[model samples]
Target: MQRSSYRYLVVDVFADRPGAGNPLGVVLDAADWDSMRMQAFAAWTNLSETVYFLPPTTLDASYRIRIFTPRQELPFAGHPSVGAAWVSLETGLVSDTDRLVQECAAGRLPVRVVGTGPQRMITLRAPRARPVGIEPPPQALRAVLASLPTAGLQAALWNNGPSWWLMELEDDAAVRGLAPDLAAIAALTQATAAVGLAVFGRTPAGADHDLAVRAFCPADNIPEDPVTGSVNACIAAALDAADALPGHDGRYIASQGRELGRDGRVALQVDADGEVWIGGHVQGIIDGRATW
Candidate 1:
């Protein structure tokens, strides 16, 4: 009944401090694990996502990772990418301390690190997000948005590795106060081939962050994702396209997961070249071994 024990870590991503951000589980010695085993462990963790690292197949990459949700494998995800990079750097697995390349199913991505120790921030250059057409599911979308005032703002569907439907409400209060009909949202996401629906709104001035954000993903079995990076990245792209950034600047801070009692802040930026990057603070909370 003995099985191999692999080194694993649980890290907080995007939190200003411990126990405040999205939690991610990572396995470092999974080079030989098959997809079935990876999925099983990912399901057991039941995190928004879990990642397994393997030796890089490409010469230019620092490492390769396979990402999984409880129900399926993901080509790319924001938190997992950041978490994996942080662990790699912390464990001395990274080739370049300043910036490293992460190879995933989505592709090779750049991971940039700033500062050091607990103050370190890791950022991932997200795949460019673009609004795509979906089969009209206005009925379900309307049902989910019922009783909410959505004027002058439009719902956008974007695919940036992890697809999502993004909506910008009137203000942060509306975004936080929303209680969407989950069933309707589930139907719409299923029909559109998206992971879920996310909403964001402008926070009042003097707030710590520029926006409030929340995500619903019944398809992925996540009712409300604490702090979502992929969705936030796409939202930044959408905002940039519309030239609607709060300060007409290229970047802003977002606050999420407060309703769930966890404080997650995501820094979003659209660079001059139009690439959206998601950055946040990451800390290793638990470093241990896992038997699978």
Candidate 2:
């Protein structure tokens, strides 16, 4: 048997500072590797998500990416997309084009890079998301919502590529104070074939962020994702559908992973055409190669 060495980079996405956001592992040149090998490497890395970069199959795309979780492969993901784009630019794989098209299971998506150096930010246009349903079935929804206040909480299921149960609490405090039943959440996600439960609440009137978010995806082997691009994207879509997002300006910041002692800031914008763009700063953490 022969072993191959592959270049890999780890980056922190949606971070206010280095090491404060979700970490993503990227295999820079994985065109030759098969799906099983990629999955094995992703599981070994033990990151929330690991991506493989390959040459694009489409004329419009600059490159292609395959996203994998420890337990499964994903059609698309928020942080991995941002992290992959950053890696592409840093490695000189792609020029400083205004925007880069990424081919993935979700299809071709556009990614834009802004700023430079530590201030550089990468934004990805989230796939179109719509409300699939409101609240899981009565019994399931009740169990999942247990141990939490329900007076003003609103719930819905949204799907872009990954399906998530989105919940809107009364305020940031309520969202942060929640003590969820992980078992029930896992069961609910399994039953609904959802990624997990994502809860958000409005921040104070004059806070720096507009919303506070937390995502739990035990079903996917993630207890709590520090910063979730996909979930926040879904949140934006849900708010837009309800006409509850900031009307004056369609741009707002979301604070997440604070409970985990991480400062994960997600930048969000809803274009006039009603498209959601999720972005944040990505910091390179480790540069190394892997052999397996």
- Candidate 2 residues 1-292, lDDT tens each? 4348878889999985787999999998787889999999898988899999988888999889999988888888898988888888888998876688889999999888888756788999999888886443757778887766653437778998989999888789999999888998998888888888998888877888889899999987899988999999999998887788853478999999889989899999999989999999999888999887
Which residue pairs in model 2 clash with each other?
A: none
Q: What does each candidate score in C-alpha RMSD?
A: 1.7, 1.7
Worst 10 residues of 2 by lDDT: 145-154
TM-score, predicted candidate 1 vs. hidden true structure: 0.95
Tell me the number of clashing residue pairs for each predicted model. Answer: 0, 0
Candidate 2, lDDT over the whole model: 0.87
lDDT of 2 at 53: 94
Error of 2 at 123 (Å): 1.3
